[model samples]
Target: MASQPLDPGNSGRNDPALLRLPSTVRHRIYLFLGVARWDGCPLLFDLDGPVSPSDQVTFYGLLLSCRAVYTEVSALLFSSNRFVIHYRNKRSLQPLRNLTPPSLAALTSLKVVLNQASCHHRREAEASGACCTRVSGCFTRKPKGAGGHCLIRRPHKNLHDTPLQSSDPSARLMLEEWRATAVYLSSNTKLDALELSLVCDVDQKEVEAAEHVVAPLLLFPKLKDCHVRLCISPNSHLRQLARNASRQASSNPALEPASPTSGSSRLLITLPREVRIRILEYTDLVAPLKEVMWNRLGLGYHYFSSGCSAWEGVPCLPPYHHGCQYRDCHGQGIIKDGIVRSDQLRSIGCFCGVRHAAFSSTCKCWAPPTPLFLICWDLCEDARFVFFSANRFVVSDSLVSANPWLAYDVSFTPDPKWLLENRSNYSWMEWYRQAQPPRAYPAHRFAATKFLREVVPADYLGYLRFLELVFPPYNHECWPHDGHPALQDWIDTVDWVKDKINAPAITLRLVMAGSRMWHPACPDDRGGLTRVQGIAVLTGYNRILKPLAVLREHGLTRFYADFAWPWKWTNRVYERLRAADDPNTILSWLEGQETLLNDRAERLILGEDQHDRLRSNEAKPGPSPWKMHSGREY
Candidate 1:
């Protein structure tokens, strides 16, 4: 039964003469009858009928009207794409293989047993549709990993069963069938999209097994859309491993996850960087307003690291072997003639902001929050006569100019010898320019850069002070001013491995810096960027200025402490580290704080694995997030 959109009078239900029409006219009439309908409507399924209480009998009679009518309508009658399966526990989803249209008969028991789960409309469905069933609010829920709710339960749950193992195998068996059916449909060539639920654990073995299970089908050539809800226990080795994998995937688009976990309320599992970026690119990321991506734009790493001619000029890498040859040119590797994919473009556009922020990197590096102002300067100096077509700054201008109500400070000024430098000095850009778009940021960019140069340096700093006043640099605040606060981006810290392959530390810095929208008003969705590890939005100037403007200023001014591992304590940790065996390992174990950079700086300077090994029988960090409560979460 479909929700009726037309009145019985207007829908032409009164005319018995409609039944006297020829078969072709009748079929066409039926097609037009169910415009925009998705329910169990007779016309929608291509069957001519006055559907009623005797639906099965009515449909069968229509099927016997004639061979021609039955043939055309029958094809559509069985074309329902949705299927449900259920199983008891996580297993190789092989039972699903039999559900192929050819093998669907093998799972006949599925239909009989799980009929209650069918989405068929009910007389009271609309009336019973209640909101805010969960007391955690409709949006939040307490499930396993993050700790279960000892509090009252949510009444209106999207998932019918519980997150924990069910006591009754009846429910478990039904769940197993559903999972198997999903796996079966996934391998189907015509499946445009899919949805599935699975359990994830913090155990390393679980992560490996999960990957192994999906490895064969994950490589599907036509598979462009995927949705998965997988949750695992907290502090599980698998969770950390997944987090690291996501971080590593910042440059790899092919590996992103398809969907948020069940409640969509809580994360079921940790996703790798590329996958996380993919989700961010598609999701409505509105909270934790202080995220670097919202403020600094360059955090869109995938765009820069890609070889799209539109972004060829920005420096970054695709995901690839740490020491692979040609690591600089093709991070993960590129194929000729591929334009910047929408995913990459959105990410780049999001950072540097399609309007105001511009590309600014030392050519090969990424990260450390560079103030929006400095990145503008880097673009001004790079190339003077660039075309305004390929870059986002132009698009942003168009958007802003159209909306006069949006507050902005985009006016720029040009430098006297803007084009004289010729971009010959930068190491990565100089060599990579052969592959980049021949255009630069244009003379107009200089104006914005210039304005930022004269006006923003202090004002923007004032904004930081305002945030400090309003938000307070609680756990970690003011990145690029120093290493970072606890839980900083993996990008700010360099992948010593990549540097080891590209060049040396000689004044080069790979530091974490909070990022924000380059053009705050721009609406495009670009995922986070950081070529070295997943999820980094980059800025050419930030790469240059973080050390120069932000950190240098902080170190030179000795402004204050209270940043990533704070400047003073960072030194003490290193001193303690020097005395420990397997210092890096010991440092990893230190739980009290979740500082993001101390390890990278040490790795960059001390050389990889050069630090003393700290022998702690227990491999863990002190003051870990599990114990110390710090920072606000949305």
Candidate 2:
């Protein structure tokens, strides 16, 4: 084969030159490269780890090697819109002072991921080599992490050394340096999107530093996009999510520009169609999803907890009519609206308020509607190639070349087809069929249908396409999570779906403690499903007739009923419904017989018991006989 071309466009596989190509050709080249990624922009560099000053300079120099290559690569590298920076040593902070151009201009999106694990371990020991036995009093001690990461020790703010201690002179100096460089980058760089991951080993202050230092610059500029990922690790407190949120500058008139994050529709509903689809794909993002992962070994119906565990105990909420209002129980609140605490033995609800809603807990009562609820607040128009939570599907195309302007196709549809395609990647059988006996925790599963309906009207193609665009965190074009927990949930719900109902599964369910109460369940259980005494369906004007039906004729009951407690364990509330009503009084509700049936009942079954009364006196034949003797002799 010809030296496989790294340069995308042109004749077969040949080592394409990195320099001196006509601008049009290069642009077109990128456009036609590998399965149409961002219109063929292939400068994807996964530099999501610790960076030495050398690494930063190297990446910068490598991109700026020659103006021709530099022009194309510079934007892609910085346009990444996401970044992670792990500082192994305090000295590593020096790179922020040397950010190059184009990269700086296109650096609208940024995410700084840090390792906050074991970030507080400290010891009282002197640097042996630096210490003189003759003068023990003069030598101060140095701290070390098992992996060689050092912690600056101090006394004022903490008894045990922590990265938060302001007493350490060196730590304070490092903090100051971070602010200085961040200010400089802000003064010079123009970024649209930004994210920061706070791993263990780093203090909330590190994240606070980014908010204080970086936000002033990035948030002020007239930009279009802004993203921030506040990742809290195991050894770290989760308070930082709220802390960073507090740094939001919605009214800073000095820097407040009219754009997405600035109180205006940042990623507008009318973003390019591609972006719209992407939004749908990633609308359900849940980072730090390990706790929410119910099953990731590819074998069974996994239970997701922690970050991705939004539906835990969420009741069977319909897609339309009802708006979402997550309320915590007595002490533990519903973990919706971006709350992640599956391990704390709490409860959840997944109830909703609409007919034809993809999911429904009770269609008895009517509730106000809201936008399609997304755990992650920021969503974009690229639902096809990103997963807000996790990918249920992963498709790879080899046709993508590089072209910043070229357009590509990504799927972010709420259409069942897209959902099915998104689901094909999972092994639902892992624990699906073999799952232990159904156990009800004190959680409730409400419907999200009302929410979906509020956000998406019944405009068919328009709504479906809209879902594709508004949803973010999906990967239909390229790059998807290897083992997507959300995708796993999708498969579990789908596979468990009785093939006969082929009706789209409406409710999203999550696992939690047995004592906790979700919506229908109690709302005050911090100990999960175990705390709830019982669950009651909401009586809404909504009712389930048939998933497939005309708009008006659908059987809707508007079910809504609050519980009185002291009854019922954790079993599905839907099973309690015996029938729509008495089967004998069918004729009273039906008109002169050719009724447009839009429910789950068969006509023959309903009519069988009813007396057709005063029928034409034709002698009826006997019922068809059993064919026991028709086969061979016994």
Estimate every model's Cα lDDT from 0 to 1: 0.26, 0.27
TM-score of each: 0.27, 0.30
- Report the number of the highest-lDDT candidate: 2
Error of 2 at 511 (Å): 14
Q: What tens-digit string does per-residue lDDT give for candidate 1 at 1-634?
A: 9643432342455434544455556656544433212443212110222225533333465556665445544444434322223332123334345433533321111111121111111111211111111121111122332222221232222322332334445434544554454455545534322222122211223344434323333433232222221222222233333333332322233442433334441341244444533443332221111111111211121111112222344322232222122112211222223322322210100001111111111012222212211233432222111111111111011111111111122333323354346544533223322222112221222112222233223222212211110011111211122233311222332221122211221112222211121211112111221233111112322332233222321222111111122221233444666788777665564432423344433333333433223112212222111001111110
Model 2: how far residue 221 lies from native, Å: 3.4
Give me the runs in candidate 2 sitting further than 4 Å from their true place: 1-24, 28-65, 89-91, 113-163, 191-634
Local lDDT at 379 for model 2: 39
Error of 1 at 608 (Å): 55
lDDT, residue 69, candidate 2: 64
Judged by lDDT against the true structure, how good is candidate 2? Answer: 0.27
